[model samples]
Target: MNVTEVISPTVKCRVHLHVHLDGAVRPSTVWELSRQKKLLLPGNGSLKDLEEALQIRSPRDLAHYLQKFRWITPAIAGDLAAIERIAYEFVEDEARRAVLYTEVRFSPHLLVGPGGQVTARQVTEAVMRGMARGERQFGVTARLLLCCIRGMTENYDDTLDMCTEFRGQVVGIDISGDEASALDVDGSVNAGLLRAEVRTFQEAARRGIHRTVHSGEAGPASMVKLAIDEMKAERIGHGYHVLEDEELYRRCVSTGVHFECCPSSSFLTGAVPLTETRHPMQRFCQDGASFSANVDDPAITRTGLEDEYALLRRMGFNEANIATMNFNAAKACFLPEEEKQDLLQKLRQAYGVPGCD
Candidate 1:
């Protein structure tokens, strides 16, 4: 499962394991959803202004980029049909780009409608409905990864309860949201916050729910190790910062914990420069560190899986290096062994490599 062993990507690699469901919605859909929901666009008072905002230069950092989510979160959360459309449209978008598989993440608590009208189960089911329709219509295999935001403690229990309720429906649990934020959504920020929060993740571990963590992107590499030794994360979301600590990076490579690198999003974050010879993606690959390409927030960054590949290509990654990332992504999925192997077999076939099955 070493990342450096991936086959040459002679064929186009379209398999993605990391994407945010709410952030993958179509731009046109965003406009329509905003209009229907009467959600005021952030920093965009007029249609002209909104257009400019969409094309606005990416914010300075991860925290800064997240500010745009205020408008996006409201538009998709309050309405059932809107959520469904968001899912369906994302799959359709995936199909158009020839992406065969993807794991989409979103927090159900954030999807609560006006007045806390929707239960976590209802919101999850709504997303499932759209996922089902999208899979059927577009021939893409997708699964949901329910995200437990770090700062939102009160709803974490309810969210985890609902996730357990829909156990067979979603693939796994993910610890997500803004780790850089000083306070949780509930206005609590004791130094012991993350220590206490690991309790919820431990519950997920006891229930045998697979876990992945959003760390090492904006945060330090130490956060990545905390997620592994403490949170039981099997893979990492945007863990490019692991390069900062050679020892931790080596540990991850040895243990086979995959790092999902979203170059376009990282470029926006100002953390990892996407240079041809200097990007973290290249560095990780060169060092044989396990990592793969992804679109962290497609709508927020306005990039897709193909564009990410293109970025790597522009950065001097050959076809084989690109294929190595595809192989790493497939092998790193939070799926059952048989399913993971099958997907890897498919990736090998697409890349014209030797079969594993």
Candidate 2:
């Protein structure tokens, strides 16, 4: 469905708190990187054609969805210049589409160059440089969230250390991979990976760092509970399944734990795993679990926040409901108080007006 048919892209005031650098690059950028790196990607003709070719098409599960990164990682993952450019470009892309605030995430470990040439610290610093430039240029304020592979606690420690090293440049931590993959049926973490995730969570808490875990998207509702109660996350990425568990639902609503709901990514990851007209988020909306509409991996899904908001509108959300989601995103974003207040004021002007309601 065309996004403009659902809502005028220019009219819909927007905010994005969940986006990934690993998946936000423009196809034109990827094609350029591939050419520079001497890699032959699966496409012909112009950058537009390459975009069609590079997309994941239809991934059925989290593992399947992750494989699409293979096309992205080799070209830019290890290159410092590519990392910086991608960061800068992501914010610029969203800024054109009216995103006032965004949170872009990536795994520094994934950028390890061949032959031990590049360090995660170097890569992360380069990313910060690029993002700062993007923010300055576009007026789209952004923060970085470092993600680690799930069940890889040492990876988490490395991520945490990067977060500490970067200080204010980094906003939070997240663990990717399916939440169920790292947990036992009893809700305990597996031996090695479990220990590391727990330790990293503790250290992040001690440091007063923010956290938002990928949970309940594909895992059981209990995974969301574990993320909040055990890991002390302030936000839950794709915690759509929480609606099935009443106690968990009550706790999430009462605690006001924000859910970063990405409509397109939900279908791609098999989180919703259905073809119904209703999106998974409708239930979350009905239950009053706070959420923000996101474009989880914009490039991989070949979509932007406009597409997500379009889907929400098709599924029966009015402009006011979508603005509510934007408000949730702006409030939960890891921005400085002064900057956040500025955004909140902008949102008030954009959303509080007559036609928006």
Candidate 3:
């Protein structure tokens, strides 16, 4: 849609968090890389065919939503050039969508070669290089968040080490996967794996790295509490289910623990119930909760920050609500205090928030 051409510079000052680098890779890029590498295609092997295969048309559960990655990951995984290209393009896409500042997250272990052909350090450096170039050209500030995938305990330490090594560039850590699959029907997590994940986050907390966890989306409210209490999560990713527990919901609202809300993804992943009643975000808005709108996986969901904001508008969000969310996002961002104030000032100027200037 060439969003860059349409969006005016005045409104291009929003803050975004919770987008995945791998999930946002351009479809055409995936098509070309897959064909060059001779990777299998879904249908006729054309770019259009690959695009159709990469996007999830039918809304499904979290597991089904995640399966779409199989089509794109092989095309870029372990390939340094492809990884860098995707990371660079991600910034361009966000800039077009009016995202002034964004923190893109990914699992470095997943990007490494199947046989350890590339190191995690190399993968992170390639991403940093691409994002740095993109920032220079596009004028959109970008940062990194290294993710630790659930059920992959071996990679937890490496993720932390990478975050420590790239402290300024890599601002925080997250654990993302199928939240439902991570817990049993009774809501208990795997003891050993949970312990390992907790240890990584504890160390991150001790080391002064910011922490966020993917919880309460496909899982129960208890999972959200566990994330904050045990994993030391300062922010939450797709925390729609937090409303399931009144105490937790109240606590979140009172404590101002920011929720990275992905409206389209919440629906596509079946995290929120499809109903005519008010959406969780509406409740969040009415309750004055600390949260921000985000695009979880743009390519897979076939959306961007603009699409997300439009959906929120349809769901009854106003300019003030969106502006407040952006302010919340800026305050919740992992940027250093000085940079954060700068971002807030920019937002205040852009949104014309009174009494700040």
Please name the candidate that would achieve the greatest lDDT relative to the true structure: 3
TM-scores, one per candidate: 0.89, 0.90, 0.96
Residue 138 alpha-carbon offset, candidate 1, angstroms: 0.8
Candidate 2 regions exceeding 4 Å error are 1-12, 43-49, 185-193, 352-357
- Ranking the candidates on TM-score from highest down gives 3, 2, 1
lDDT of 1 by residue, 71-145 (tens): 577777768888888988887777766677788889988888768777777888999999899999877788888
Instruction: Give Cα-based local distance difference scores for all models.
Output: 0.77, 0.80, 0.89
Candidate 2 positional error at 234, Å: 0.4
Predictions ranked by lDDT, top down?
A: 3, 2, 1
Clashes within 3 Å, all models in order: 0, 1, 0
lDDT tens string, model 3, 133-239? Answer: 99998888999999999889899998998999999989999999877566766777655547888899999999999999999998888789989988889999988
Residue 145 of model 3, lDDT score? 99
Please, what are the lDDT tens digits per residue for candidate 2 over residues 57-85?
77588888887777778888778899899
